[model samples]
Target: MKTRIATAVLAAALLTACARDPQPASLPPAPSATSTATSTAVAEPCASVITRMSERERLAQLLVVGVDPADPDAAVRLVREQQVGGVFIGGNATALLRNNALDAVQHAARWGVSIAVDEEGGRVQRIDELDGTLPSARTMARTKTVDQVRAAGRERGAQLRARGVTVDFAPSLDVSSQPDDGPIGDRSFSSDPAVVRAYGLAFAAGLRDAGITPVFKHFPGHGHAEGDSHAGQVTTPALASLRTVDLVPYQDVAGFDGGAVMVGHLTVPGLTDGVPASLSPAAYRLLREDYHFTGPVLTDDLGAMKAITGTYRLPDAVLHALLAGADQALWSSGGNVSAVLDRLQQAVDSGELPATRVTDALGRILPAKHACG
Candidate 1:
């Protein structure tokens, strides 16, 4: 009886650890970078494998290009040709989600490709048409207990994983009270940072339970931004004001395992100078240094968002995002795979973007991937 109790206690402890540290037991750590791998077993020693990859492959691994949901062949071709890290399955289309199209894309990669989606639920979900509905963050907070919210996330996550999704960009960590339909409005769990932290972590844990990596988004906080980056450049409150409220939920994520962060395009008065957070070195520095977040840092959409397009083209935006310290740059409009790779190669050849940075990005990326292939 004592042995049975001890065994149960140990199993519970390990499961708790698995949620915070996703690295598989069999994989070797990436050179000079910490491993952020999922707890699921993987066939390859991916971290060690990344060190031997080509310079261009290393750079390619830093991008998560968009894939049209209606067309699956394009995604497979893109990864086969460019050896890019992952493909973003965005928008409301259900064609790709309906079949095993993603499996073909996954097998096309020599390494592996991460299949990511924005499944935050309610106004922002990718698979609800086929799987079922999920309440918005506000509704989840107001109507359900934290445990219920976690269960909902787990159920939705399992559904997405079944559809070949490996990463979910969800559970907005922003603290806000804006109108329900505004940019962050109901997407945010609550205006209270503490509530955001509790509900956000609960949702994240649920996804982790289902073997889907949960990405805590709009880092440094997007809840209080003055405008929507989807339409135009947005600015946030000064760094000091952010530190108390908007930035509070982030404090819990630095140590969270099997997770990632999405940096928004908002410009902060005291931190970003005049650049959006997605393109600012200072903003990344704060996330890396001040917050001590070591997981994969991804840039929010740079292709369609006006804040990025208004200032730079796709190629230049990708370059800027890399130099700004993002592990991967997401462009969800779904084209320009070859053109963008060519541009990034040119930047590397000219020493505009250092080779070491590419390798460092790969170190974080390889370990963080859910290995859909």
Candidate 2:
């Protein structure tokens, strides 16, 4: 274990030394799908906002809390007082309910907060009634052309944007090689890596065309995992297989300017020391060094997932995530966000966690928020 950690730390240092800032590039064109929004100008530079914020406020910006429709007041408090950076709408939040809640939260926030939803279509659809449904990713890959998939993405994005959603966590990039795989299965585009890449890019392109930021998810692949991360920590394929097969889509999408990536909770034996990727600095190092992803890296739900809660509770899990290199820690189960924010402030004050980590995280997160506007 000591040797492995040393090797991982060395690899990260080397990757950092060799890393170059990525040149901004336009998304590759699909048949009829062109990006509606360009990176011409950010309305408010994230750097400016970071300079003006207090340490606690800056830390708040790195948290994406899950809002429940049942407790609208608590959700509003999270945004208004805690100054949470974003909200993920789920748990009985229909379109109307979600929109109403978002309106209230936005009204409470001093700055624009990202409104995200898991609108992947098919089974993972969060707001089916409001956004409507398309088709499963597998079915879309099998039956539709790449252009058609792009069109579907545009259509979905339009619905989400209309309802005030800025981020759509769709276009699963995990190569579903095994049909009977526990978590991914039909959520994936195809068993073939090439097919998954083509369709995933198309779907992401469509989302970008509609002015919704597309977040490609389950980084380093989840298709081959034997168990679900939501239930407990699941082991994944070795690094070689992940780089060649699962990580290809992420590497391909790195050139596009308007996309984010969500790291999952699976434990990679050789890479993360059996810790879930969301809380593994080694896993994040791989994403930064191996994949060259510069955009915001969000965690899968932090509160409900047993992989996290079964081990560390709220504020501890949140701290580990930030320390592990995630730009945003997503807590989908409702709780007093202020408590977590306070703990983060204390950690930073006592030299337990560096202030630069908060600033660096905000540097990545604020730009995404700016892009949403």
Could you say which candidate leads in lDDT? Answer: 1
Model 2 stretches with alpha carbons more than 4 Å out: 1-45, 70-73, 95-101, 371-373
Query: Backbone clash tally for model 1?
Result: 3
Q: Candidate 2's residue-wise lDDT over 1-373, tens digit each?
A: 0001122332333244213222224321111101111112223465666667888888888898766555567667778887888987664346324535567777788777888877776666755655566788898998999999999999889878877788988778988765533378778998888999999999999999999999888887887776776677778888877887877777787787899988888888688777788888877778877777777888887766677666765676778788778888986655547767877888788876677677777767777767223
- Worst window of 10 by summed lDDT in candidate 2: 29-38
Model 1 poorest ten-residue lDDT run: 28-37
User: How accurate locally is residue 322 in candidate 1, as Cα lDDT from 0 to 100?
Assistant: 81
TM-score of 2: 0.84
Per-residue lDDT over 1-373 for candidate 1, one digit per residue giving the tens place of the 0 to 100 score: 0001122332343234223323233432112212122222223566568657787787788888777676677778888988888888776667778777788888998878889988887788878779888888999999999999899999999999999999988879999999888789899999999999999999999999998989888988888888888788899999999999998998978889889999999899998778888877777778877888878889888776777777676777787778878889987665666677888899789877777677667767888774322
Candidates in order, TM-scores: namely: 0.86, 0.84
Q: What is the lDDT of candidate 1?
A: 0.78
Per-candidate alpha-carbon RMSD to the true structure: 13.1, 12.6
